[model samples]
Target: MSDNLKVVENATCTFCGCVCDDMNLTVDVDEHRITKAENACILGKAWFREHGIEQRPFALIDGHEATTEAGVEEAAQILARARFPMIYGLSDTTCEAQRVAVGLADMLGGTIDTTTSVCHGPSGIAFQGVGESTASLGELKNRADMIVFWGGNPAEAHPRLFSRYAVTPKGMYIPNGRKDRTIVLVDVRRTASTPAADIFVQVKPRSDFEVLWALRALVKGRKVDPSIERRTGVSLAVLEDLVARMKRCNYGAFLFGMGLTMNRGRHFNSAALLALATDLNQFTHWVAKPVRGHGNVTGADNVVSWQTGFPFGVNFSRGYPRFNPGEFTTVDVLARGDADAALIIASDPASNFPKPAIEHLKRIPVIVLDPKATLTSRLARVAFTTATYGINVTGTVYRMDDVALTLRPAFPSPYPSDEQVLTAIRDRVRVLLGGNRLPAGAAPIAPAVAAAS
Candidate 1:
């Protein structure tokens, strides 16, 4: 890669829901680096800052350095012999990689779950209860005259969301960006992004579901006493105004965040939003999109759903994919100490998992495959550092809207890409299975490189 020869490939930022596209890259082929980026949000810049890697590949065996091949073999042996195994963490890689991972898990009669099971499992449950109406980012950008930010701050969590697509930016039909869109903020506390909104609705913590339901009732043209106002902290008049605006808009969009899903109501909150969006469609067009946190969390859902006819929290212990969010989720399985071993790829669970799960991890052996020194890596029995996906390798990742996009590398490195590492693991797993029935296979997975190369 040279500065003069740097090519910026058109793609979406995989970091968050506002998948901003049209990013520019200045790669120096001669220098083997990404020198600059254009049109990416602040978080996107941080995502690309550690472009190429310099760390040599090695593994930890019994808390000691060893070859990655030895580690993989040891991991394979443990997983193969264990009565129950869990394969988790698929929220930061390509859909292709996620597919291969789930296939191996199914063949081994293990559980395959994603971070969503812990972060947005409730939302998924709610989705199953009441289906949602959704629109493409392009549609929202072009036609949505009213946009609401509920329980999220895109400026920090999804840095370039407003400037790239949702609130502030101009689109094909939106000649004037900020002026054309009406912005509303709903949160428990005020943040940097909320202050800039045209309307800010402050609600009590963990009362998102109650507040939303009340608003939905108001949207349906129902009258309520002041007690409803006392409960939601928003006057009935204010709720009526939001309903009126939503009904008047040609197209209305709601960009929801983890706050709704993580609070007391959990999945019901998601159900309410979906139901509310559906309700709004009775008079005017309305839709909602989850403000996802991980780069490939959406990809995990897409891959699993397409492969095994189910989404996250899929169990394969019975040699067939079974969907059960509450039982098969990573937290539930680990908390019960059902998993004897684990193979975590592309995420850091040690920092995010609950106390019980972390305690269990300390007692069990873990195999970690990632590009950085994360909390998960620190505790793993075997850790292998591979090439960074967007910088040293290229692959396909799905956007928040289920739009698949290609991520191209701008620099070169000695480390093999994620594809190579994944293919290696699959081959090793195949050898361990020896013609076992696999459920996640979509293609004849060839080895990308020698397992320990």
Candidate 2:
């Protein structure tokens, strides 16, 4: 142990959606790196250990090193000149940065989308169609006695979810912790998380909609033939028993994942599950929430929804905000070659998007802002190396349950934060567009401008 080490107590880990805020990080100030992360899981430890100030250029333009000022100027010019520009990837950043990005998109009259479009976009759609029954993670931890995991393997993805909040933790009502709670795992196949379940129901591939539909029927006291086992691979007896447990439990929760959203039925599958939770409230308390993947993705959704009146895949091209998923979403717009330029922040779409979207992105003038170099930054026309949130930068990030937590930086960074850089670009774009038309607090569009358009 070095005498010069600095320990930051109760620091937040932004590696995953868990956003565990009880981390104790020991920083080697001389080396500008985190040496120890106590009370962190395997993923959180790796996240804290792997991040530090890297020896990279502050900014780049056309693959050539340049000053941060030059990069911001070029990025502003590119975005201002494009007819149909797009802004994407606000998942990994802070809520402050996401708000600036949304305001920038409004200023440029460009489309703005988040990484949520690819992950839980369907869940958002379903939520809009049929409202969700959700509760805070704290409430579930202290009250829930029956927890069901659907289409998600939290053991591998969210390692601390069970130990810290859901399965093993002792609740007020569940004094016996894991013994008092009933755990149910539903998935297309058995996974690493199967071991944590008292009952694991493996369904046929792409049969989530069928299984969920049958469960809904059973919960509603409707007739469901036993032969449904042939279609979904889950016997009707098990579904009936599951429904009985859901109705009997004092508090129940459904923590679903991408397995239900990205499949064949998409939002319909999510709607069925949510509808079942609503139905279960007649007999007992039940809630459903999508197990988010990114640490700040839920923040992105909240910021965008409040700012633009939509969750993801929003467009401001009509001089006002508009919502349409397939049309304005990042992948769909890129795949269709509609966007002439792009401004990406804190995400890598090159490695994550489809072939058609990647091809179009390569052909366009793309700008990226991230703490580290990524596949998207490699092809960017302008890129800014910003300070990492929850590490070298301080801001507010939303937990998976939409609870905002203030970040405590372990150490300072040499580079600027995303909020500072985006604010500069936005100011430059406002000047280039000819006036201070849309100020920080004003509506996205001026009243007369929106009326005229």
Candidate 3:
């Protein structure tokens, strides 16, 4: 530390899918805090306001405190004894950690996925069924003549997204960014994202799949009554107008969020969106990207797809990776009370899961590794606190579109990294599985990473 040496503030916005790269940060080294952040969103501001060191690490078991090493050892024992295991949660950590997690799932003969099953699980299904047509944010900013936000309100979820990338700011191809693009919003209610759009089509709740089907019918030239409305409350005229725009645009992109994927129809709704994107390709170029919530959820999907030849919901119980969504997913397994050990990394299922699932988690020997004290960590038999991926460590993350971007740490911490803890567990598993006196009486492992691979 020098008397007059100015600290440089550099960071990428982790608040949304846009992943805004240029934000000016001012730090107070004396207090170890951020003083000012320029060109960021409201969400970003709120996120930075709390540097969040007050969240001390704790190891709890049966609603009481336990030793950290004891917690890890107990968690390892649980995993070692189970016939079926689940290594879930990767929304808040680095892609590097995500990669390690999937690898661990492969080695453990278990399943690995995120909470996306509740959010964009449907979208992923649609993607696997009929691949999405999507583009980079840079491409949207510069070249897209039309942008349709379906089942998403980026104005609130991603505050700086429109201002910095898609609608407002200038770009290479479209100089006067927003003025050059036609923005349309489609939702059941008038939320914040509706006001900014040039056209807003209000549909009824839970009819997104039907609406998409009707739109596809129109695109394909089959006739339909203009007066008949479906569950979404959107009219044929409105659908026609939107269809026209899809035909007229030089290039377009549809950005959807949790609204489309998380409700009654779930993955079927997501599959419709994917089908609509494919239908649009018949007339012109149209793409869709799920407005994923976590900074690197897509990173989890990509890593799993590359390693296991499928995304999430993978089971290796037979010593080989096998993919199944509903049967092998986290919620179903938890509900069935089948898995003996659960490793929750960077997630809070206690808060986010259904009561049955959370109850199952409470009954089992659970291991949680996170950066903060959440309900999930509080219930874990072995809880380990690790550095925040985007805030305290540096690694790559994937936006919803599968674009890899680096996450820069704004500060440092005393906690060991997520990778360190997982690697330790991995080594412990190797020793325990070797069956040579158990390295202090731990259980044995079946196979290592090489055999699993």
Candidate 4:
């Protein structure tokens, strides 16, 4: 390795929600690529390697190449002129950027939502309904004798979850690591993580809430109907045995994912899981955590909560923060044709969102800020390819367990950070709005003055 090459130690990998912060990355400054990444999983390696790629133009305005300033100006004009606008996709960016997005939405008196609305929004709702008993990953690794993975497959999605957190890692209380812990996996079918499970409970599809409710009944000493086995696909004897061990375990942890949040029951399923964890606390120490998807979606939720007083699906059109899922959420907002323009950052909703939402994006003026050209960018009237966070920009991100971690960049980036661009646009909008503050601590926008006009 040449002296010109820079090595970043203890660098964080912002690929999955795991947020593994033990990577040692070697970046070739001249080539602007990561040459080597030690202690990184496949996903983390890919995330770092892709940071050096800049195949797309720096910025684009209606399919034409433009400077960064021109792109910001156009984005500001679009938001300032719109009656209703939305700012979405903060899951992949830093908390600093997410804060600016919230401020931008307040200024526009528009709606703002994170990708969490699609993934873990139900979990957030459930937490509000029935408060959960939760702990950090370190607690599970150290003190948990029984580790449960429900509706989530950590093997494929979070590659290092087991090795770094629960099953394989050695800790103070679990000195023998895997030998000291009993891993349980509950899903509709066997997954890659099933092979490592000491117990596998296969339930019927969309029956997770039922199974959880049954377990809660069992924990509460209520006699559950024997027919629950037929409905859930898990035998009665299996349920009884599982509940017995759960009560006997020194410390148990239930880690659930989208299976519980996205299915028919939605927030009710998550509520049942959390309720079960709380119920088990009477017999033994227990905790539950939602398996977050993206690297910084948890951070997005946190920043939005602290800044806007809500998690996701927040609306400011009333000049005050109001949250109502399924109504104020991104998908519903777009599907209802409530938003005339959108400012999307670090997310590709056009490809990932439902068909109706994508159709709406096609008709509206869309602004996208991302490092890569995504399907959403193709439809964007103004798209600016920005730097990848955690690799090229330094900021704070929250782990799935709500642990805050500061991210350091391994290499400098040519593109401006999302915070810089959003701040510039906000400043420009401030000027365009005649420099008066709005009701929601936002700069006033001169009505009827169109940016594209």
Candidate 5:
């Protein structure tokens, strides 16, 4: 350790989608490691402290250690030779790397999707169906007087959400902060976040759609069956009171999470909640936002939406972008054995995906690019041990509330960044597939690169 350490202020922490940007990092220049991270959450501190351990080969091909160039070239050859290829996992990387991935899909005439396809894909589908009424965290901090947490355990997942933005933050309109806010938690069971709520509504599991639909009907001044209480485990009186209070609030916000999106009804559950939020806006200022899970999943959605004209589950097989969630999503594509080759970056589907999908993924030629070794890397044909995003490379990432913040690197990285590796692969694949030019009718990648910059 050096006596003189490097100090980096205002470095963004990319652990979760919160993107907390006030961290002060102390870096050991000689060791190229983060010694301390001030003003960081537990997750951020753990993520920062674990950087700069690059003991294995920076790149591997067919389980053999290889140079980065040879690995990229082998990966390019595999992707260029494949008839059906799919690229996945941009939630943990920067928009620059994500753009390169989209371009690679275009050049290979394949498909490109993100990690959001597994977690919040249904929310994106519902957003397209009913449109989202969302506001940035700053707006929530300043004006929201009533906050609802539906099926989200922010206390455990997003520890700083309450203190930094939602419930406890002191803003111009919220002079008393938590005292002036009415916090409600709606989940199938009690969670760590329940203690922070002024009121907790525990509904029956697998009945969120029914409850949300009944609430929407109640909000719209329509009569609902009294048996909803028995079906959803929420009394009629409580539902009536909740709806009445929602209408009375000056500003209300509903922050839902995977509880709604990952359930039986999936997209319909999210659509019902979003429609309820929109209906409430008729009487008061109300909005709804999905509680995204990963660090840059929101940014991945933004980049994919603006670049490919769709959110997740986008396909470029016909030399143009086409989207269909269940059909083109990564899990479904692998489960159906549609993708002959897979390029996974910063995600480990092998560990989390269904057995069928994992089986099919194992059968394919998989290329993995990640900072840490994971289960997916063990089965990959080519693996690139890349640098962690915020610790070793700078990029723009959108917070959970869709607020974009520029990340600053705290120290030097021993390995290449995702952008550098993906760009090198994209160029190599393009040359191997055909000329350096993109196929006809393919969307230009320069615009996406420009937007990311």
Candidate 6:
């Protein structure tokens, strides 16, 4: 043990959607890195240990080093002069920064989208069609006796989810912890999570909607063909047993992942699953939630929905916020060459987007704000290195369960926070667009931005 080591207790890990906040990080102040992370999972330990101050410029303009102020000025000018600019990527950032971003979109009258458009966008659409029956992680921990994981492997993706919250933890009602719960895994094939489940239901690929539909029918006491087992790759006996367990449980929860949302049926698949959860309420308490990927992505959806009326793929070009997925989504807009400029925050779209979308992003004048140099930042005309939230900066982040937690920064960064940088850009854009005045009947910016702060 070094005499100069600093221990930060109860630090939060934003590596995944779990948002585990009970880590005790041992920081080497002289080395400017975390030496140890107590009470952290493998992923959380790696996340805390790998994050440190990088030797990169504070800002870059056209790949050249420049002052942060110059980068903000150029970014504002590029956004102001563009015909149809777009803002994307708020999933990894804080809620305060997300709100300012929505205000910036309104000020520029541009389209604003989030990573949700790709990951759980279909789930959001399904939520709108068939409202969600969700509960907090605490509720599931304490009361849920039957837990189902549909189309997601929390073992590899969210390492701490089972041991910390769902499976192995001792809760108020679940005193025996893992012994008190019945874990069911529903996926197309066997995964690491399969070994953890008491029952693993392997369905045919792309047959999630059919399986969910059959389950709903069985729950409703309606006649489902026994041949459904051949269609969905699950035996009728197995389906009946699963439904019996679900109906007889004290509390049951369905936590689905992109497997259901990004499949062939997409939103329809999610809708059917949610509708099944709704149907299960007739016999027992049941809830469903999307297992989000990013730590603050749920916060992004919440903030965007609060500021604009929509969750993602929002267009403000008509002097009001409009909700349309394919038309206004980042990938669609960029692939169609509709946007002339873009502002990306805390996301790397160039590496993951479609070829056409990546090509269009390269052609446009792009601005990025991220803690590290990412593929999107490399292609940006103006890139500002911002502080990492939940580590070097403090703000509000939402868990996958929509529980809001305040961030406690373990260390400081030389770079500015995303909220500070976005606020500066917003102020500059407002000045450029004539002193906070917006088009007739548009949402007011001052009030919304202030409320977010």
Could you tell me every candidate's TM-score relative to the true structure? 0.92, 0.96, 0.90, 0.95, 0.95, 0.95
Runs in model 4 lying further than 4 Å from the true structure: 1-3, 435-437, 440-453
Error of 6 at 423 (Å): 0.9
CA shift at 376, candidate 4, in angstroms?
Answer: 0.1
Flag the better candidate by lDDT, 3 or 4. Answer: 4
Stretches off by above 4 angstroms in model 6 are: 440-453
Ranking by lDDT: 2, 6, 4, 5, 1, 3
The local lDDT score (0 to 100) that residue 282 gets in candidate 4 is 93
**Clash totals in order:** 8, 0, 8, 0, 0, 0
Candidate 2, residues 187-235, lDDT tens digits: the string is 9888989999999999998999999999989988999998899998999
| C-alpha RMSD for every candidate | 6.5, 3.3, 4.9, 5.7, 4.0, 3.8
- Model 5, range 132-180, lDDT digits (tens) per residue? 7889988789989999999889888887788788999988898999999
Model 3 Cα lDDT, one tens digit per residue, 141-185: 778888888888889998766787678877887887888999988
CA error at residue 225 for candidate 5, angstroms = 2.3
Instruction: Judge candidate 4 at residue 80 and give its lDDT.
Output: 93
Per-residue alpha-carbon lDDT of candidate 6 for residues 359-408, written as tens digits (9 for 90 to 100):
99999999999998999999999999998898888899999998999988
lDDT of candidate 1? 0.79
Q: Model 2: clashing residue pairs? A: none
lDDT at 130 for candidate 5? 95
- lDDT, candidate 4, 335-416, per-residue tens: 8888899999999998889899999999999999999999999999999988889999999999999999999798878899
Error of 6 at 321 (Å): 1.4
In angstroms, the error of model 2 at 229 is 0.7
Q: Flag regions of model 1 displaced more than 4 Å.
A: 1-5, 437-453
